[model samples]
Target chain A: MWLRSHRPAAALMKKSEGTRRDFLRACIAGAAVLGTGGSMELLEAAEQSSALVKSRVVIARDPMLRGAGTTVDSKRALNLLDHAMQALFDADHPADPWKNLVRPGDRVGLKVNALGGHAFSSNLQLVEAVCERLQEAGVKANDIVVWDRDTEELERAGFHISSAPNHVQCFGTDRTGYEEDLVTYGSVGSRLSKILTRSCNVLINMPLLKDHDGAGVSMALKNMYGVIHNPNKYHPNGCNPYIADVNMLPDIRTKMRLTICDATTAMYEGGPAYKPQYSWKNNALMVSRDPVALDYVGWQAIERKRAEKKLKTLEAEKRAPLYIATAADAQHRLGTNDPRRIAVIEAQAGR
Target chain B: MAREMISLADVKFPDVSPINEIARGAELGPRLLPLDRRSFLKCAVMAGAVCGISAFAEPCAALLPWAGGPTQGDSQFTAEARFYEKLQNKKIKCKLCPRECVVGDRERGYCGVRENRGGTYYTLVHSRVCAAHIDPIEKKPLFHYLPGTLAFSLATAGCNVNCKFCQNWDISQVRPEQIRADYAPPKTVAELAKQNRCPTIAYTYSEPVIFSEYLMDTADAGHEAGVRSVVVSNGYMQTESLKAAYGKMDAVKIDLKAFSESYYRDVVGGELKPVLDSLVTLRKLGKWTEIVYLVVPTLNDSDSEFRGLVRWIKTNLGVDVPVHFTQFHPQYLLKNLPLTPVPTLERAKAMADAEGLHYVYIGNVPGHPAQNTYCPKCRHLLVERVGLTTGQILIRKGSCPFCKQPIPGIWHA
Candidate 1:
C-alpha cells in the first residue's frame, strides 16, 4: 500500500552531442587546494543553486556496459555518465552538464557507498569518470574529494587512499575526522565529516543501487548517512524519518548538487552489502537533483526485479522505503515522492 | 509538478584494481593479526602509510600484535553475538536490545559493531579495546561497591542509545572500525586489570550493553585472575540479554537518562520502561546496582520527574539502592542548554531524600558536602570522597562506625 505504482511516468530527454576530443582537450590541473573557498562569488552561486524542488530523475541504461562478472567497461561507463549528466541539467555541451551542476571553483565531494566491498561496490570506474567530468567542467582535480565512512571499507571496496596534491583525492571520513560540533536534524545528532564541512563546498552523491534489508532501499537520500559520524543510530523504524531528516540537514539539503547512482550492478535483495546470488548486472546509471524522486524510482526498479525473481515485494515483507514519502512530507518538503509529480527519463545513453 | 529532471545511463566504468584484494582474502579465510615488532611496524606502514588506517584510525599506544592491521578480517576480534535469531532471507532479529533490529545479510544492527553475516550475527567489536584507562572506582560513582580503589576501565565503540548530552561522544557514538582499537582479548583485559592493581574492571566509556559478549568474557577472565568486573551502562537493553550479560557483573552503574518516556524518546533515543525494568531485575537478582540521574537543565530536571524517579526506585527497587544526581554540562548536541544548575541536582537529591531513599548524593561537584557518604541513621560521615579521590573511610564491618547502623555496601573491598 505504501508504493503507489510500480512504474513512474517516463520522459527520456535527448542526449547532448559532445565529441570525445572535446572532453580530452581540457588539461588536468594540480591537486586541489583544500579550504580555498570561492567566498567572493557565493552570493550569485547560492542564488542560482536555490532552485525549487526538482522532480526529474533520469535512468540511463545500456545492457552492454557490464562485461563478464562485475567488470564495467570504463570507456562506455564515462560515455553514459556524460549523457546522464547532460540529460540531468538539460544541457547541450559534454561539459555543460557538470558546469550547470557545479561552479568551476566549487569544491566537490563524491560520497560513495563502500560497504559492499570490491566484488560489488559503487563502480570505481564510474566515480573516476565523475572526477574526470568535474575536471572537464574546470573544477580542479585536487578540489574533488571522494570519500565514505571508513578507510578499511573504502579500501575493501577497492578504493586507493590518496591525498595527492595534484589529483582527485579519495579517502574516508576517518582521515579528515568529524567536526567537533554536532549537527542535530530531526532525530539525528551527529558530527559531519570535516572533509565535507571544511574541504568541499558542494557534494556529488553517488550511491550504489541496492535494496536495503531494513530501510528497503539504499539510494540517493540514504547515501548521505556516510557524511555523518553516526549512521547506525538512525536505522531503526525502517530508517523512515531519519533518512528524510538527515537530508533535512541544511548543509545536505543545500550543498548537495546532484545524485549519480551506479546501477551498472544493482542488488534486488540482501544488500547494503553484496550477495552474489541476489546480484544482477543492471547496466544503468541514474541521475537526479531530487533525491526523493530518484529513490522512488530506484525502489520501484528493485521491486520489479524482486517480482521477476519470484521474491516477495518489499511492502509484502514490511520494509518499504517509506522515507521517500517522508522526504516529500510537509515537514521535510525535500522533493517529490508522488509518481504523478515525478518524471522518470529512461535513455539508452551510449546507444 | 516541479520541473525536476533525472538522467540514467549504463556506464561501463574502466581501469582499476586493488579492489580484488578482499575477494582473495575472503577465499583465503581472513587476515590474521601480526605479532612481532617488525611485523607490527610493517603492518602499520602498509596499512597506515597508504593513507589507510594509520592516517585515519590512529593506532592506540598500548597496541600489541596488531594483526588485522585495522582494515578487515580481524577474526579474533569477532565472535557470534548471543541473543539473535536468524530469520528468512538471510535476515536476523537481534534480541540484544529493545530495538530488536531485523538486520539483513552483511548489514549491522543499530549499535553498528555487530553485523549479520550470512544469517549469523557476529559482533565485530569482540575484544576490540578502543579506549582503556585506570580510573577511580568512585569515578564510576559506585560509592557503595568498592571505595578507595582504582578500577581498570575499557570500552569498545558503539552505544545503543544516543544521548544528546553524552560526555564521551567521541568514543561512545562511533563504529568500532571508525576508532583505533587495541586487540585485547578477555585474558588480556584481565591481565591488564591485575597489572594496574585495580580491584575491578569497569566496562565503561560507552554503553556496555552493546558489548555484552566482551563484558561476559572479560568478567569471567577477570574472575579467574582474581579481579572483579563492573559495568557502567545506559540500562537500555532487553531483560533476557541483561539477565545473561549483567548476571556476570559484580556490580553495575546505570545512567538513567530521564524519568519520563517522552524525555527518553525525544532526548535519549530510547524508551524508559526497559531501563526501569532492567533496574528492577537487577534488584531482584540482588546484584549491587547504582543509579545516576544526569539532571539536564530543562529536559529532565523537573521536580515531578525527580520525585517520580525516586518514588519508583523506592517502590520498585527499595530504598537501599544508592542514587547519584550527577551534574550535566552542555555537551554533544545540547550545547545551547546551560550547565545543569547545582540547585537542580541538589533539588533532585532533596526530593530523593524526602522520598525516603537512604543513600543520595550529588556528583561532578568536587568538594560538595553531599559528595560524602553520611550514615542514613546517625548522619555520621561514613565515606568521605573528594571528586574521584577517596579521602576517608570510617565504615567498619559494613556498618556506620559512629552509630553502628547497618550500611548496605562492600565497605571493605
Candidate 2:
C-alpha cells in the first residue's frame, strides 16, 4: 500500500476507545502496518486530549513603550523577557499555559533565527533569559537547546556554544546535523531537524525581527523553516502554501509550544538578513503562544517600518507573509482579523 | 583555439555475456544506434556535438549545461521576467511554471526569488550567485557528454517544489535573502569559468528554471567565452519556457524523482507529467540529456517498479540516453530508512538492464565498473572513468583500438 493511504485518525481512535483485548487484537492486525513498538494507549489519550484542539498563542507586552530602538540595556531586556514569558505562560490564564500546556521534565527546544550574521537576529540576551527562566520553572537547562541552521552563523551572531548542565546550550542543525529524520508535514515529506522534533519534548521558537524576501515577513512560522532539511524548495509561488504546508507538518506545528519574535533589532525591509539601511528598529520583543498571530503582528510591524521609511508595504513589494493565513486555515482558525478569539497586548519598547 | 591531442587506451565494455540475449536485443531502438567502430563513436560524441550549430547556443546551454559560476555586474539588476500577466487591483498571476502563483501588488512567487511588483514578475536571483565552485562534470553525472571535463558550478536559493529528501537543502530549499549570495553577472560568471579552467558552466544545486533570465545571460556569456553550459533540474517546467531555455544549454540532466505520479504529488508537491514532458521535449530538441533516478530506499527503489521506469526511458528517451540510478543516503525528512544498499543498487542496475535499457549506470557508489564507458559490439572498455577523472581510453579515433568497434561519445582529438 502507498504510505499515505492509511487513515491517520484511525490509529488515534484505536488508542482512545479500544479495550485491552481490542488493543491486542488491533496491535496484531496493525503490527505489519505500524511496524515495531506500537502504542495505542498513549496515542488514544493524546488524540482525545483537549490540548490539541486549538493551541493558544500569547504575545506578552508591557503596553507602555510601543516604540523603541534596538539595543536596550540588559535590565530592560530582562523586563521584556519577564513580561513576554508571563504573557504566554501566566498561571492565571484559562488555558494554563504552563501547568497544563507544558508538563514536568519535558525537553524544551529554543529554535532561534541567527542567520542574519550578527546584525539583525534574536537577542541572545533575551533567549538566555528565557532559557534561565525555563530552568527555574522546573524545566532542566540540560534539556533546553538554543539552535538554528548553522553553528557558525549562530556563533557569528554572538551565541556562545554550550552543553553543560544548568546552562543554555547553543548549536545549529548543521553541527551535529540531522542523522535521524522526522516526518515532514503534509504529503510533502521534507526532513526536519532531529534535534527539535526527536530530542526535545517541546519547541520554543525565537525568530529574529526581519523581512523575508519570499515569505513577506520571517516570524514564528518562518522560523520553523530551519527545522526541515530542504526549506529552499518550499518557495515556489510566494512560499505561501509551502511555508504554511511545511509548518503544518507534524514534527513542527504539533510540537511548537511558544514563539517569541525578537524585534529587538528589527529588520523592517529587505530582510531575513541585515540590510543595514533597514536596521536599528528598537528593543521590542513580541512573545506569543500562537505563532500565526505573533507573525501576523510581526508583519504589521514590518509594514509599519516600511511606511516610516516612506517605502511601500510588504504587499506593495509583492511579499506579504501569507503563510500566517495558510497556517490559520490549516489549524482551522478564523481569518487574521477575526476579533472573536484573537488578542493583542501592546507594550513599551524598553523597561 | 589550440589543437589538442586526445587518446583512448584503457576503456572497457560491460560483460554482456551474463545478460539474456532477448532482453539485450530489446534495448536497442527500432532504428538501433550503429554498433560499428566509426558509427558508434559518432553516436557517443553526437550528444554534445552542437558546438556551433545554431544561434541559440547561449540559451540552449543556459537551459541544460548543468553548472556555472556565480557572478554579477554593475548593470541595473532589475528586469521584468516572463510568465506573469497583469490584472485588476495591482495583482498578477505568474504563469511561468505549473504553479500559477497569484500575487497582489508586491509579492514574490513560491520560489522566493521571483516577485510580482505592481503586477510585474521580477526574478530576485537575476545575475546573483549564492554558491559557485569548480566540480567534476561527473558530479552533474552528464556521463554521455564530455565526461572528464570540469564544470564551473553555480546556484541561487529557492525552488519550485518542496521535496523532503533534498540533498542540497541548505541552499536549494531556502530563499535568496536567507542565504549569503554575491553579485555575479552573466559575463562575470562566464569569465570566471574561463579563468577557472572549466570547459562547462553548470546551473546546479538550486533549480535553474527559476533563474531563467540570469542563466540565459550567463549561458550566452559562457558560450561567447568558449565555454559550454548545462542545466541540472527537476524538469517540472512549462514547455515554452523549457524549450526556450534549453535552446542555449549544451546538455541537460533531468532528475526523474520517481515513476509513480502520486509520489510526485504527495512527496514532491509537483506533477510527474511536466517532468516527463520535459524529457520528451529535450529528446525532440536533440539536447544532450541524461536522466537521474534517485533511488530513495523504501520510497522510490523497487526492483519491479524501477524496471518499469527503465522500460519507460527506453520507450521515451531512446536507449542511448544514459540512465543513472543514484544511491540515496538518508536526508532531510525521510530518514527512517538506511542508505540504499550497494546490492540494491546492483539489483536496480540488473533490473534496468533486464528491461532492455542500454547505458544503465549506478551513481554515488564510487569505483563501480558501471561508471566507465564500453563498446557494445566487442565488450571492450572504451573509456575508463574514476569519479570525474579519465584513467585511460582504449578507443582510438572513436573506435575501440582492440576490437575496432566504434564507441559512442564526444571523442575529439
In terms of TM-score, the best-performing candidate is 1
The segments of candidate 2 whose C-alpha lies over 4 angstroms from its true place after superposition are: A1-351, B1-77, B401-406
Task: List fnat per candidate, in order.
Answer: 0.80, 0.32
lDDT of each: 0.76, 0.65
What value does DockQ give for candidate 2?
Answer: 0.18
Docking class of 2: incorrect
Q: Which has the greatest DockQ? A: 1
lDDT of 1 by residue, A1-351 (tens): 111111111211122144553222111100101112553243223323424223678899877786554588898899898788777666677787776667678899899989888877789999999998889888998999999877888999999888989888888888878876677777777778888888888888999889887789898989998888788888878888999999878788767877899998889988776787888888899988777888998999999999999999999999988888898886776767878667788877667
Question: Residue B75's C-alpha lDDT in candidate 2?
Answer: 35
lDDT of 1 by residue, B1-413 (tens): 01111001101111011011111222222223223554344334433322323321222233223333543446978999998998987889999999888887777788888998888999988888766655567777789988978777778888888887776677778887666666778987788678667889999877889899999999999999999999998889999999999999999999888889999988888999999999989988889999888878889888888888899999999998999897766666888897666778888888889889999988766456787899999998988764455667998999988888999977665
